[model samples]
Target: EAAKVRLADGQGREIACDGVLLTGQFTPESSLGRQSHLQLDSGSDGPKIDQYGRCSDPAYFAAGNLLRPIETAGWSYREGRRIGSLMALALCNQLPAPHDALTLKYAAPIKLGVPGRLVRGELAGLQHIQLRVSRAVSGTLRVRAQGLDLWSRPVSALPERRLLIPLKELQLPEHLDQLDICID
Candidate 1:
């Protein structure tokens, strides 16, 4: 016969609540990507892709919440439309295959970074790189390649919200195996 529940915080604070409802633990469903043998991004637990959304197989492309997870409907819709157009171009042989691409490397508390790979020549249309953090953080987010600072900005982010890094001013080196995204 419990009328209420008491929750204790790490800082020694306690709160009484009628109930606790926990949510937002959604993970992208990637069984199909697995069965299809597409390269998987451990960060998003989805198919790894380039800025244009081309997956490991040149014939396969993925987009939207399927690549991330549980974004707003509007975001998913826009992403679908954008990637759909790219798919059409690919079908017509107008889209260039991913080359000169750099793999993205990030550590906690960065939960994920969209466009798991970045293509140098094909980056013109990509406006921003979306990111999600595993927890709350406030610091300067930086992107580095070939020991050079490609981009940096101060950010305050929470787990439930998506963060965007604009690519308009970003520049990467011609010869780099990976790009590092970090917060410091």
Candidate 2:
């Protein structure tokens, strides 16, 4: 038999409890991605993908919260629609392959960045870069590439909240090996 759990408030007063319910350490279901040998991001524990949602295997594609878990259903639906269209284009040979894509990395408080990489010519179509933080922070979020500051903005971020950095405002160089995002 399991030991009975006691309930209590901040006042140190005990409250009666018949049973305890536990839930909510949700994670992405990525067993398939793993079995397929897809590269996974250490931070998100999801498949690494490019802007078009293409995984390391050109034949495979991933989208929605599968790329980064725990987004609103609506956000997932929207992402599905967008990436679905790209997938369709790919099937029709209408989508161009990414030849100049660069990886986007993060450190410390930053949990993950969606799309995982930056695709050269596709930057014009990218509206924003979605960022998830590992903890609550209040500071300037900065993006740098090749020792050059690309973008920075003051932000107060919580682990549960998603941050958006407008891509249009950033003047990223024509060629970059990697882009880094962090709170400074």
* TM-score of each model, in listed order: 0.84, 0.83
| C-alpha positional error of residue 69 in candidate 1 after TM-score superposition, expressed in Å | 1.7
How many angstroms is residue 129 displaced in model 2 relative to the true structure, after the best TM-score fit?
1.7
lDDT of 2 by residue, 37-114 (tens): 888977788898877788887688887778777888998888888788878888887665666678889878998887
Judged by lDDT, which candidate is best?
1
Off by over 4 Å in 1: 1-22
Alpha carbon lDDT at 131, candidate 2: 88
| Residue range with the least summed lDDT across 10 consecutive positions in model 2 | 1-10
Task: Write the residue-wise lDDT of candidate 1 on 1-184 in tens digits.
Answer: 2234444653443356566666777878677897887898998888998888899877898887778877888988888888888888888877765776789998788999988988777435446788999999999999988667889999999995888888767777777879889887
> What residue pairs are clashing in model 1?
none
Determine the C-alpha RMSD for candidate 1 after optimal superposition of all C-alphas.
5.0
Task: Output the TM-score of candidate 2.
Answer: 0.83
